[model samples]
Target: MNYKDYYKIMAVDKTASQDEIKTSYRKLARKFHPDVSKEKDAETRFKDINEAYEVLRDKEKRAAYDQLGSNWKAGQSGFTPPPSWQDQYQQGNGNFNAGAGGQGDFSDFFESLFGGGFGGGQHAARGRRSMQGQDSNAKILIDLQDAYTGATRNFTLQDQVVDQQGRTQTKDRTLKVSIPKGIKPGQKIRLKKQGQAGVGGAPNGDLYLEVGFNPDSLYTIEGADITTELSISPWQAALGEKVKVPTPTGHIDLSLPKLISSGSKMRLKGRGLPCKVAGDFFVKLKIVFPKSLSTEEEALYQSLKALATNSDKNIEDEA
Candidate 1:
């Protein structure tokens, strides 16, 4: 199979963060979403974007892809995954399904790597008679605050199921689920009997909802902890100040220590996600200077520079 550069397809760098990948996917998905686009290759591009996102969005898949190295490019001839690639993935619990029922219109390259084309269906068919309904998987995007304080979210899941006559059909089901406080990303919230219906009156499979946070402009989550940048003026950082900072719970007065440098962090205990034990909220200090200095500001800066230069000379002389 030919090599496909997923990062290039998504117009992101290989080092792009999860948030950046999500942002790019949203922007491109809208532009080429087939139903909404007037472009000639809208359908094809849409499929490609989804295929790329299917791998890139997941941490495990992205890691496996990265292990393949950066030597291969799109349309590279005679490209193949490493000899141990299949074994590594098979042993791991990586979900190879690109989407519902693993029936997405993915490329041969993807199928070769992950092996979830017709093979998945064939495997399902073998034990179809006595098996319970296949477990359904879907993602729910919630705000960071939703994790702090539990929320009720509604999700529409599209699933493929076999009908009574053995014809496969697509069905859309809506579910309203309660998200528990402090739910971490990649954690599955299983809903019993909400999956595809089973044959022969067997019990229905459960639905697994993966918790994912929507990209927030102000905050980033790490486990139960939340981090955000606190921009302060140079004087405020140097002189220290009591600033009102926003947290997941609410706004609070944060005391910045005197002589605190840029990139320093202040921890607010018990302000993070309210799990069994509350996590801490962290504020990374960022000292910001005025883009343009006024006449008085310029004079003050020059005076400070002169004093610093003189101090350095005095120290040198004393040494």
Candidate 2:
């Protein structure tokens, strides 16, 4: 677990209003969303943004975090906490505990600074009447290729657990998970009896794993369909030919119809993510003209212009 500066993550002033926080979050969220963004480390950056928003958006949590003073830097290791940190506020009726489930994966420094139990008997009580153990959750990000062909993923989880000293300690556990074909983001896969331990022989709650997609450079996924923009030379659009296009699986030769207009989209049936009923992949053509043409090319264009080729495709006529 690492210490994170929520204010820096959201790029907001410490005294920023709720609306400002929300606006910043929305902007950053869209920029870093794995589905649409092509930036490197988009998923990690998006998770950090979500984690920041999770704490700062909440009034109580924000206030508590603010009390730590702006002097503390993120990722400051081995700094001993002040003894009288929590003396200003007494632990109340578990409002802080209530937030554990929804809050983004928090760090050890955050939990220690806040001074409340996020798991154990109290968490179990909140989930179900008979359960006496907390429900742990983790998010798994997989590539679109993995979804097409199911995969076995090995993940190590750092979970907070209570020790004999009654102090909370983070324990690491590794397990291999089977990613079923056709799983989508935001869907949770529940594993029964895999959560925290129960109190007094009570039944333990379940673990929920949320699914997400890895940030891909060449594809934008929507449901099962994949969309990618392809830049084509002017001649390629004018004269139909076989072109090589990249898919998540591999590059394949696709036939382009002759005289296709710029911005025309071509679809490949059943070439997207695998599902019970799979979707199509769409390639949108974008005509890219050279910034500077060669002398011969210019002469040819001038001749074509003189031949009244422009007469057939005037902007006004199209309009």
lDDT of 1: 0.76
Clashes of each: 0, 0
> Clashing residue pairs, candidate 2?
none
Tens digits of per-residue lDDT for model 2, 169-274: 7889886888888776677778787776564455676788998899988888888888888888878887988889998788998888888888898999998877
Q: What is the C-alpha lDDT of each candidate?
A: 0.76, 0.72
Best by lDDT: 1
Per-model TM-score, in order, reads: 0.57, 0.54
Assess candidate 2 and give its lDDT: 0.72
Per-residue alpha-carbon lDDT of model 1 for 70-95, expressed as tens digits? 53344577887767766767543435
